[model samples]
Target: MANVIDTLFSASISRHVICVFLFISLVYTQNTVVFQPPFVTATGPTVTAFLLGNTSDVSLSLRTVSPSNTTGSIGSPSCTDEATRWVLTKEQIGKTAVRIKLRLNQSLHFCGENETSTNCCTKLLCVLEALQVTACVGNTPKASLLVQATINARLFPASAGNDNKTVIPNQVYQPLGPCPCDLTVRVCDIRCCCDKDCASEDLKLFASHCLPGPFGGQVSPDPDYQCSVQTSKNSPDWFPFLCVTSPPENNPYLGLFYHGSTITPKSGPSFQRQIVSAPLPVNMYVQGSPIITLNNQYFSIPQRVLGRCVNGAPVAFLENFQVECVTLLRSCPTGSPLQTLPADLSLKVMSGQGGNVVVHVTDKVVTDLNSFISKNNALSSAAQKLLCENVTLALDYKFFWQGNGITAVTLTRTIGTLISNVSVSLTTRYSAVFLNGNITAEPNSGNPGYQVGKPVIAGTMDNESESIQRAFISIWNPVGDGLCSTAEKKVVLFGKNSTSGCLLPVGQQTPPQCNLLRETVTNLQASLITSTYVAKRGNPDLLNLTDWMNISFVTLNSSTAMEDTASTCSGIPSHQHILVWSLVTGLVEGVPQREIRDLQIRYTLSTWAQDCGGGNSLCEDIQLFPITSSVTFIDIPVITEPPKARFQINFTEYDCNRNDVCWPELAFPITRYYTGEPYSQSLAKGMILVFCFITASILGTPWRQIRQVWHSIAL
Candidate 1:
């Protein structure tokens, strides 16, 4: 117990020096002073230094100091000593003891290796001759470092050219940041797999340095940095995605990896490939003509033409004069023959009637004068006794008859007589009858002038020479005997006796000379009684006066009773009995006046005497005679012709899809959507479930725990 074990070794060396000063103050307040040669003076210094040893014994030294004006000159330098000789050098690697490693390619330097003097082999051969120098001259060598000790510190960004200067191992050196407000860490991607695979890819994988997140970790093998390679979501299916951020001085991990995927980009496909390459097609043509031209009438009969088609083809129009074919030949099929004409001819005549006759004859005996005694009893009694004994009648008579009846007869007569002279006086004797007469005193020679016995009046003493005597009686009379008399006493008379001769004066002796011969027979019987001789003897028996007293007593008793009866009946009277009794009484009286003159004849006659004897007649002696001969008729007139035909038309062109090859349907469908802003707020629905649960919890962690907590961060 050597003094009580010296108090237990002085209390265990003071509790082991208070547990080694509380483990060095808890590693100097949470082990964050890792500065292995880390140095950064303002902006430039020939050494950005750092080296915490392990990776093999720490030996990273970079030192550059120029800029001096006779202050502490090394190799005479100015111009601010090549602008403070930008520099960098780093080395800090430790595996257990709370791990820590960072070897920034040994560190950096310049300023001609600080005017060398074999200063660590001229600053490690001037950083290995600036890594085999390909091209680098000015300004890009700026340097910075602030690594303290214990652990947690990084500032990697070196490899520039010559095939990798080294610093990759899960790279991420995020630095540059300011310009344009840290423009995504000043246009990030400093190589090293474009800063850890395009910093979580997307944002069009940092699109060829149009930068933002392929930050400074310096590991460029290019292939656009293959961090397990994955980029192409088909390039966002075709363009458009941009995100850029960062600032307050740098590494905001490229503004948190491209600000949430470029605030919603993706969307492309060239507007649906330009709407399927621009579109167009649909057609029709038809101009005019399915046949037309009428009047010259080719109506082409189809019921009278009407067909149609317009925008396709085929058309016609003519109707009714005869030729129809309406609407694609409206079911045509009835005897077919489609039109024509010509044929009709004619002419005519016919007639009747033929009867009639008349003839009239008239004579009426022959007008007047007892019609020539009834046409002279038709004449031939030896022509009426040579026209009544040579035609001599007194008072100028005239009669005529010729042809057809009396055949011919004519008579005419005229005769004359008158004579006388007588005078005798007692105081003056006068006696006449000179040439054939007697003045009986020449013998009475005694004179009454000679004296006479007074009363004895010897007048018979014959001569009495009386101085007055005259005689002028030359009478030879035959006043009227122009006999046309049928009777009128067939006159028998004679008396021209100068005292006795040519006499037939009969009987009674004179006594005053028989009273002057009975006063000359009473004045010749009163001048032969005339009624125009009894109208020319128109027989009233000729107006007889006892036949004029029997013709004056038969010529004075035929010489005094035949000389005194010829001795008293002279032998008993026989003289052929008086001429046979007058020839039998004139043959029985001429057979009863010739049978009454042939019954008053009317024998008809008309010898065309020049056509009834008038002037200017011709034209076949115009008696015109046609009273009636013949004519008769009834209805009439006729002529005729017409009938013949044939004609055609058939045109067709129809097809609205009757298996006739498509094309004809468009009547109204075409609608397309999605343009940006997070797919248009993810197609609306209140931020699409809170941005799809924060992007599926950031891809469900474990990406090496966010790259070891972002490479133990201490920029």
Candidate 2:
């Protein structure tokens, strides 16, 4: 029994030793465990609290005067002690509440005992205590005071669904009642409004102030008050007070300084007051008187005679008049009162030769008279005698007397015979005369005194002339008369024999011979004279002889007889030789001298005669004569160049008086610019090249690129 007991004791001892070794090993390799109180309570007039250990196993301790006293409740002191206590544990981590009731003027402290007083002395104070329960695995432990409370209560570890028994969480606290307070005052820059008592109540905030010259003269704060200084007269400066004045009214007659004053004109006469003289009359012609008249048998006088004052006397003047015979005769009758009287006439008075006096007259019958008379008188006297003896006499006398002045005695002729089956003709020629003078004559009358028809013979007979015998033969027996009786004695024998039984001695001739001789004597008159008788039984007067009619018998017989024979000849005998002679004179007056100047006058004469050239023949001839006259008045001198002195002008020295010589010149400024080469060649060529290049690039490169891309995409 003693041995078994010894064995048991030995085994117990061994176990105890093992146990101690294991305890040492565990202590060497594992974390140490510190023992702390499970619960802590605090109650004191002033209290402080502390937490120890890590979050994994936290320790709570109370610092109070009587923390071990149980009789003191957590926040109040009991009758036996001045302190109270409570516990902090794992379950209380989030479910715990801390309350601190601080008295006025009392102080409480946290973390260490009485290290510093809390601000709760002026109010309630509270705090949250956190205990970090971290694992003892190579790390330091952290504990915190997370939440605090005063009259306001707070909880720690907050209310949450999941928790690690570690860190203390944040909490929210609310005041149980009105929180205790302390008051403070501060100053701020603002405007305040005043109350009725003038005390400020509301505030007005102001914008921030900007300093001057802040932007280095680039920007300005106030632009309205800016000013600039002017440098010269042309500067762009504004002055508000100045303005231009209005111009005064203009008047040319008044001086510039004499406004509103009456101006006196320089002395001169008005046009109405000037004196003017009348023009004097000019005398062109001197005055004189001259006589004028119109003869009764020739011209008709004007009914109202016009007169002009010449030498202080009114003188009757004649102008244009007409001359016509009362009887329808071409020539005035023999012994007619106006046959030798003046016809149309006019005259005027003149102080000098240059004065004008004109007379106009018409001589209707006088035209071609001189030419006719000249031709008729040219016929042989022997031809006249033959006609008288061969044929019974028949006389036709018609005459017109026309002249500007008195008509002088002119010749007349009577036709005593006409031969049957024979023709006689005469022709006249004309000449031109131009004269300048006035015509005067008597007034016209209806009856010019003369007998109508009667005849008387003049001049002595001559029996020896051969012309007389021819005249007798032609007058009584143009175609051969009855034969002479044998009892008749021939006073003149006209045969080729000198003596024959046909002749009878003188005085031995019987009554038949005397009768034959008387007949021969009657026919042998030298001049066959005719006269005008006023009545059937009135004594006849021979027509006044004029020098225009004188002619030799032989000459007359040779020319006249041949002419007569030739005129009456027929067939081949009509071509017998003939002779003619003529004399003529013409008078004219009152032709203007100027009209005759440089004048060409032409005269035309014509004749027609009948002849037998076996069957029938007519002869006609014309002659033209021209005369020219040039007149120049010696009274008026010729002037080749006229005077130009009236139009000549003279210039004086004062004509060009002027003070200023220069005047403003009109000018304009012209600006010139250089022109490039023609645009059509230079600019258009460059543009065309550029356009072609662009078009080619677009057409060729882009198209190729597009085609390549398209093909690749298709592949």
Candidate 3:
């Protein structure tokens, strides 16, 4: 009886402690206060409550209900009836709070007042544990009120499967909890020896590659600390076991439970700053900075999205872009001009400084569908009937900036018909030029000396008129495999001398029809300049010795003209070579002036050798070869025999300023060395004179002493 009393006393003390803890939690927890409304009353199987907040619309959703604890004896009636355990209804009270009414069915029973309940309240057998009420207001932050009730005891212990907290997996697949390799059920996973479904045979085959146990299963003793030993090991024979290939798990992030500073992620910037209000701090613009615009709205560039025009794409600063989009036109205008589409609207240039916005330039798109049709003569006259066509081909933009911001902008629109219904083979180009806060001029090929990649200054000079005119030379450019008929002409760039060729057709006509081809070739060669004189600065200045010079042609061979066979196609030159000689003249303001000294063209006339297939009968199918031309530039100067050098010695008398003849203290020779000799050779000769004086002193003194000794011996 004394032991029973001690047990009862312990039970009473435990109940009292739990009641005190519950009261403390009710007063301290801020999140729980949102759920405990001012009034809650229960009648029979129904519950009614009034929630807080009158401005928002409140709605309730069931989250969780506590499980019932019933120890059933053998053969006892089973717990049944689903309809009796139903719950329902919620409504908003007029401008005061929300009213929630719940009706419980008869299948759920209330606990006895004196009984110790499990998984629910002592007074109630089945009770709500968690409920989420969402309150929403128009254009306001949504509020979520979460209500969770605490009980003295629960039927089931909390496990990973029952836990409400979410876990985000790492990028690399690693075993979490107990079964990382148990990814499939009722089937043996490949190379997964740890899978329970796998038989002994399957594990034997997987032994070569599969790891012994769960990957990354070892836990660090200290939650706040980590080391390399915790990293997951990789199987040598197998690739990423269950995830995309990743490096070793050296990342410091130790799951959400690790102790560290909580970091909330933020989104990237959606819009750029306006130019008018932006301060002038830096000269160059960064990648995401706003483009300078006249209006307060954001500046947008026309872009192509999936082959169609997407007009309002935000333009990034300091980015070069090009886009081509297909635009649909309803019809070619007959009486009235077609209205401009939003994509065809112009962009205005805004000054990148000051408080007030200023417009500096504006551009317009020029659409001439008629001109486009006329240019392509192959187009049918029914172009007007096919009015619903894709016409806009490309849009080009060039932005000019001066340190602080963009100062000018130019737009060029190229309108043309599309080859297909959906797309066009065109692009919009963008370029930015920094002027350093000044107007920029066109760049020159070279200031004085020629730049390496810059085009050579080449033109034709008239001998009779003494004038020069600029001209460009072109060569035959074969489209595919050097076919003659399909070849196009392309201009040659200076310094980039290259050879190209195309086959020429030969026809057997009465007066040798190839003569027309020969005449055309001669006319092109006639305009080439053989010799010319050029000035350094402007026109030739005769008085300036280094101002002007004459450049002429020189040939390697004695022959000046190509050899030709009369009345035959063989006379046509098969190959022609243009050789240019140039040299650096003088440097003007740190720029080298590379001047052309000589130029010559050598021609190799073809010879006809026929192998007759019809036994010496007039060879009908003669194999004619292609004509080729090549240009070569040599950076070598002309060579000439230098004049002989002469030497003269000059002697000046000391004090000669007052007297007619006074002996000088020093005199030197006036001499000139050969062009290739080193200037240090004169100093070497002076050193030789000093060596002679030292040698004479050593020999002459010894000879005088020997002679004196000889005289003494004779005496």
Candidate 4:
């Protein structure tokens, strides 16, 4: 293969069939043939450029490429308008001898001026259809190629190849295992529920979109998207479980599967499509109306984001056209075709917070160039933002599952997949459930991306049953890898063998010796997962999830440390103090399952006796906080006020009974009221000294007589 190569459909002279038996020779459709066409491999910093040319009175078409030595797919008429690229197959790696049968299949004749005409030079020569190549960095030991391409931009010539082999000129290329990563703009790592941490019972996640698209599939607009929300999963029946799954490779986009139950993809509901005026923003990844969530489960009307050029700058603009939003969430029996929206419970639509976003949409997807020019007048700078021409398709699908016991759950998100924006998260109604544990994710060798499912009791396991032992969940990556870093190809784990207790350095403590541990990813994917930096959109440092996470846990009277006292949090601060510690717990919520004994302290708020104002106040003193707050953990605000003061009886000094009145009437103080501030005995002593001085000078003796007596005594 030569370097600096370009496809030349030249028309300078006569044509001859040059069948050079160099690497391969094969016949495609009887009408097309492929000579060992010259190809340029990458040389140093420069890569091979396929140049599709146009000449006078001649047109060439590349019919097909039948590889004799390797297996791959080659687009037809690849040498048209612009240079085309090739996507190599995984099977082609490591073979030294490679050849292909290049053929020219179809050509439509075009009218040109006569040979003697003056405008003959303007005759079109060749067209390079959207096809190109990918550059491969040959790795001797591993069959995977480090591929790079330029499909999103124009400054470079292109080629195609799968994880197989192919290269594009001028595109940023870095290998994560065998995958080629590209991020022209930026990715949205939207923080949904977990802030700094999601251990508090008050956590929420929300999403909204107009021109939403389906995951692993194309974008469309039709049926509108909507959702029904239950702010309280306290009933447990409201905690929805999801079974996110995929069929065979024939249907990569169909992941009607998840943690709660097992269902066939065909059994899933079909999406409804319609024509509407106000479409959602384009480029939706997940689509669900009335998103339902619980432990290890989540549902959302996901959509993708499409971008366009504005005044020469590329800006993400939702498809300008209307869309058919899929009804992904199932509606109650009270629903009909016109009433598919969630009927039972609706979210309060908390604007600008907790998963809710305010998006400004415009009609930008104009697939029709003529319509774009005609509709968008000279004033509309968005004319350049043509995303789609016609109406967008609605992603209408419903989710359903029947099970028992509060099922421990899992939501598997594919890491190290093609698209980075595909995300997954879980949320419950305000105060519905408290979460604390660890998150586990890793690649599934039998599958593509890593798994995001939780192991919970389902079917006969009623999700609310005590059988569900609260364990590891939504915590930070146990390995301490960054969000996107561990996300590429890794599995997060949580619970019983909770790492929260382990303090030893990694690899230092033997497995079983630490009680809790983490699993290992395969060699190839591990290479990328072990990196300290989060390589997203080529910016490895894009996100740092070190302190910020949505996974945590809480427990009452919880203890993993041996020396820990039962009164660790239940005892009063001091005998003189009025407060009694009733209990202590670990943060129990989503996936933060660490149990450090040293870090354990008196978790005073959760554990306490009846509200005895201060240390001795009666039960009636305890009450809810009188003030209301706008800030909240989902539906509930900070609350449950303790008594203003407490009291206690003291009889250590003397008789505690006189007339049988055991209270304050007794000789010794029976009951002592305790206000937070203390009275000062030192202040009383200072006051007495000042009073004595006043008495001596003004009341004890006349000023002149006292002075004479004092002088005589001194003489």
Model number with the top TM-score: 3
At residue 670, candidate 4 shows an lDDT of: 20
Candidate 2 lDDT, 86-170, residue by residue in tens: 2222322221212222212333432234545344332224432212122222333222221112222223343555432222221
**Model 1 — TM-score against the truth?**
0.10
Give each prediction's root-mean-square deviation over alpha carbons: 94.9, 87.5, 37.3, 30.3
Which residues of candidate 4, in runs, are more than 4 Å off? 1-715
TM-score of 4: 0.17
Local distance difference test, each candidate: 0.21, 0.23, 0.43, 0.22
Top-lDDT candidate index: 3
Error of 4 at 449 (Å): 22
Error of 2 at 507 (Å): 21
True-structure lDDT of candidate 1: 0.21
In model 1, the runs with Cα more than 4 Å from the true position are 1-97, 102-107, 117-125, 128-715
* Cα TM-score per model: 0.10, 0.11, 0.30, 0.17
Q: Candidate 1's residue-wise lDDT over 405-494, tens digit each?
A: 001111112211111121111010111110000112111111101111111010111122211221111111221321212112211111
Question: What is the alpha-carbon lDDT of model 4 when measured against the actual structure?
Answer: 0.22
Ranking by TM-score: 3, 4, 2, 1
What shift in Å separates residue 83 of candidate 2 from its native position after superposition?
Answer: 99
